[model samples]
Every structure is written in C-alpha cells, then in structure tokens.
Target: MKELLKRYKYAPADQLPSYCIPITVNGKTCGRLRPITPDTLHSEEEIRLLTEWRSASGEWFTTQFPVTEHGTRQWLEQQVLQADDRILFFVDDEDWNPIAQVGFLHYDEVKKQCEFDNLLRGRKGRFGNIMIYALLALGEWSIRVLDLQTGYLNVLADNARAIAIYKKLGFQEETRTPLVKQVEGDVTRWVVAEDDDTGGEAQRYLVTMKVRTEGFYETLKQIL
Candidate 1:
C-alpha cells in the first residue's frame, strides 16, 4: 500500500466514479458517505465543529481549529478543488446538513486499495457508536462501488477508543512509524497522521491498519 505522503497525478475528481453511499441504523437514517462538490454547504460552524472534534479525539486527525470563514473556504477548496489526489465529501442525514466526512486519500485502482483519511464526526454524529456506523457506510461502499479489496486506515497507537473501533471493523494494525514531534503554540497534547504538524503531533506514534472488503458488502446487505 502507498503511504499518503507519496503523491501522483490522479484523474479529475469529477471523472472518477462516485461512491456516495448512505447508511441507516435501526429505523432512522443516521448519516451517509456521500461525495462532495464545490457547491456543498459546509459553513464555518461545521468546519470549527470538526476541528474541535479532531483536536479532542487526538491524532486520528490533525486539523486545528479557529478556521475563519475565509480559511474554512480555503480548506474546503484545498480538499476538493486543489487536491490532486483524494476525493472528499460530506455525511448528511436528517437535517441534510453534514455531520462528518470521508476521504479516499491514497487511491490505487490497479491494486484495489485506498487509504481513508479526514474521517471527522462532530458532536452530533451518532448516538453511541458514532464512528462505527460512519465507517461501515464508507467501508461498504469501498468494497462494492470502488471494487477495492483492501482498505487502509491510519491511526495513533494510543487512541484506544479508535483502535478498538477499527479492530471491530476487522482492520489489523500493519505498521508503526516513530513520529518526530511538531507542535506550534500551546497544545495540551500532540499527535500526528502525516508530516503535517499543523494538526498537532503524534501522541505516541503513527500506526496504520489494513482491512479487506471481502465480507463487508455481504454483511451490510443484511443489516442495511
């Protein structure tokens, strides 16, 4: 699998086949793993909510807060407009407003593999299993639509809550890299995903896990 740091020219985001799959829990629609467009309405509040969530959740993500209105627009453009790789989108349900996002950061169609990053769920995510249901929606899409065999998830070793969630999803830890500290200003803790110290720094170290999409679709079909 290719690390996210390595970049290559990818087809335009519009040219790629979209896998914006929605998920339901119990009888209600919880959220979705939808595709993002230039017109997607994610305001500064949503941006700040995600930023605060990541900062509080530790190093699974590295985006910081105080993203001003202008800065938030730039960040959105960077993810969908300026990005040469990775396709990003919102996860919306009841209110048609997004509560989270999913990204295919490193895509290798030939290898049937991709790494997911920028999975952020705000305080209004799910009831209890916030992250699980979101991931299931995306993971199911990865298997069915993308035809991917292996999905890579990067996380921090010390984030037990997140690690347990991944394990339940059948992701197995594969690699761990000793991350160098990179902190700007006063951070209560530092954890990292990539070399971008902008998020914070690695709490302990950076670790990646791999999961196959073999049984995901079959399982989701029965439940959702």
Candidate 2:
C-alpha cells in the first residue's frame, strides 16, 4: 500500500495508475474523483482555477491567507505532488471538468489511520451531493486499497451543514477542542489553545470525527 501511494505521488500524471471513482445516479454517470497531479494541472487556466477555489474557500480552513497563482503552483509542486503522505483528488463532472477538491493526509503506517483533508466545493449548487459522494468514495478506497484501519476529519463545531453531512456518512464525533486565532503578517492560523489562554472566549471550536474501516464500505453502500 505504501509503495502504491508512493507511485501515485511521484509518477508523472500521464504515467500514473488509474484511480477514479465515478458518481452515478439511476444508472447514468454524473461525476468522478480523479487524482490531482502537477502534470494534471500544468496549464495556466488550471492553476488559476485552483487558486480561485482555494481563496474562495478560506473561511472553512484552519489557515487563512490570500491565495495566488504562484503560491498555488508552488504548493502543488512541493506540498502536494512531492509529499509522501498526502494525496488529493479533483471532484470533476462527467465531462472531466474539476468542480471541487478532496483528499487525505497524515497517514500513519503503524496505526493505519489517516485524516481526510482539503475538502472544498469550488462550484456551488452545480453538484449539490457531489462532495458527499467524493468523500465516501475516498473513504472506501483508503480502507480497501490502502488497508487503512481508521479515517478521521476535523471540522468547525459551528459548521452545521458540514457536520450534518459527516454524520450522515457515519463519522462520529471524537473530540471538540477550543482554538485560538493567531495572526502573523498576511496570515492567520487557528491553533489549539488551552481554555485559559483564550480567557474563556475561544475564537472557535474544532470538532474531530472518526470512522472505523470495518464499517466504511457498509456506510458507502447505505448511502448509495
């Protein structure tokens, strides 16, 4: 599994192995989840779209910073494509146009656990339930193909919409920790801070949720 992940990460996009999850409704294909690679997004327009999407979804993330094409391209090359433990996929329409991004990171080889990270729906209202399908597909793939024992994700406690969707997908809350916002020039980071550090008025609460690999496929089946 580790070797497979390494190949997926380092291989050129054209030479990469096929790993796609198709979204279907009533026997008709609707969208897919395709792996994101540097080669897959070498075009200027692709980088621009990714930058715009990341910038637009800033409110839901732990780090807030102005996203730019240059930074996004660098991140794609360094942080994503070259990282050994991270893999991101594009949520695309049936025609293969990217609509959103979803992926996993922080994989623990000994524990067989990983966190589902970088989930953002760039195109709103176009595919209402596409993100849900994308997550389910990713979860199933991780458990079955990668032999992951557990998968988890963190969400803002006040994000009712995302929490509700996560509940429906069979993730149960594990913890809720207070977070404090720390600002550094041109950037703001949400860090887990002690209750006393925030003077009883923390900036936000981060809710961590986990799902067991044994029940992952069953949950996907129920949703489908």
Candidate 1's error at 211, in angstroms? 0.4
Residues 20-103 of candidate 2: C-alpha lDDT, one tens digit per residue: 667665456778777776675578977887898899878888899989999999998888887788898888876788888888
What TM-scores do the predictions have? 0.69, 0.91
> Which one wins on TM-score?
2
After the best TM-score superposition of candidate 1, give how far the Cα of residue 212 lies from its true spot, in angstroms. Answer: 1.3
Q: Which runs in model 1 stand beyond 4 Å of their true positions?
A: 1-20, 26-28, 41-67, 183-203, 215-224
- Candidate 2 residue 11 Cα shift, in angstroms, is 4.4
